[model samples]
Target: MRIEHLAFNVTAPFEMADWYVAHLGMQIVKRGETGCFLSDKSGMLLELYEDAAAPALDGFSFPPATFHLAFAVDEVENLLRALVKGGGRQEGTLRTLPSGDRLAFVRDPWGFPLQLVSRAGATP
Candidate 1:
């Protein structure tokens, strides 16, 4: 069986959903009183909602090493700058591997870590 959407318990589903759409290029599949479902350009699903009965997964508890949403980027530096300008915080220094892959980390407004990756040939 294949996995479906990944879900997150957030304080503000509506606002966080909007933020992801604005900054991460996600499209809202559906939004309702319960929560918001978002899809990447490729149609990978992510659900954001508030659940008073569930534990929250903010960056403080999860931390970058625990988990992060990664995305392929044409230019890590450029997208890194955009993420910060869009209210994300720089989590660490940019790194270029011997294989020529570029990697950068940042945290969203709610403190979720995001990894921007540029494979060796993915970027000029």
Candidate 2:
């Protein structure tokens, strides 16, 4: 079966959800006591929830290099800059792959890794 959604356990899910909606252009599909469900522009769902009994994962402790959510963007540098200006942090310098794809890395305010990529061909 194909994937329907992915879930994230966060400490401040409500505020985090707000940030995502504001900066990432996500829309709220539903809201619950623990958290909310968000949909990306293409309608993929992201479940952001809180579990008080479990500690939220810290990006530093978990190392974002091992995992990140990548988004296909039209302007990597522009969106990367906007994300940082909105509260995210830039990770490193942007790079252009030999295939001509452009990439930039950044982290949310709470420190979830996000990759902004502008594909070169056939996938935009």
Candidate 3:
């Protein structure tokens, strides 16, 4: 079966949703008092739920070090810059793979690691 959607437990659902919209170009498909669903128009969806009582955890604990979300972008550098302008922080420098693909990592406002991959010469 094909994948459907990914969900994130965020401290501020609306803010996180807005972050995705502003930085990643995701559009809000649905919204509720406690959560929101965003779509990138490519059959991929993201769900953000508010967690007001979430406990604070040390790094590499709650989310686990291996958990992360990746998104394909038309331009990795532009997206990385936009993410920083939108309050997200870049984790490290961009890298070009052997296949000539470029990738970069960034953390959302609440510290969710996200990978920005370049889809150069591909339609958005």
List where candidate 3 sits over 4 angstroms from the true fold: 51-65, 119-124
Per-candidate count of clashing residue pairs (backbone under 3 Å): 0, 0, 0
Off by over 4 Å in 1: none
- Clashes, model 3: 0
Model 2, 1-124: lDDT tens digits are 7789999898888898999899988889999999999998788899999997988767655555688888888899899989999999998889999999999889999999988999998453
lDDT of 3 at 50: 71
Report the Cα RMSD per candidate. 1.8, 1.3, 3.0
Best by lDDT: 2
TM-score of 3: 0.82
**Clash pairs (backbone) in predicted model 3:** none
Task: Estimate the TM-score of every prediction.
Answer: 0.92, 0.93, 0.82
Candidate that scores best on TM-score:
2
Candidates 2 and 3 compared by TM-score, better number? 2
lDDT of 3 by residue, 1-20 (tens): 87788877767788878878
- Order of the predicted models by TM-score, top scorer first: 2, 1, 3
lDDT of 1 by residue, 1-124 (tens): 6668999888888888999889888999999787999998777899998888987777766667679989888888988999899899998799999999989889989888889999987642
Cα lDDT for residue 82, candidate 2 = 98
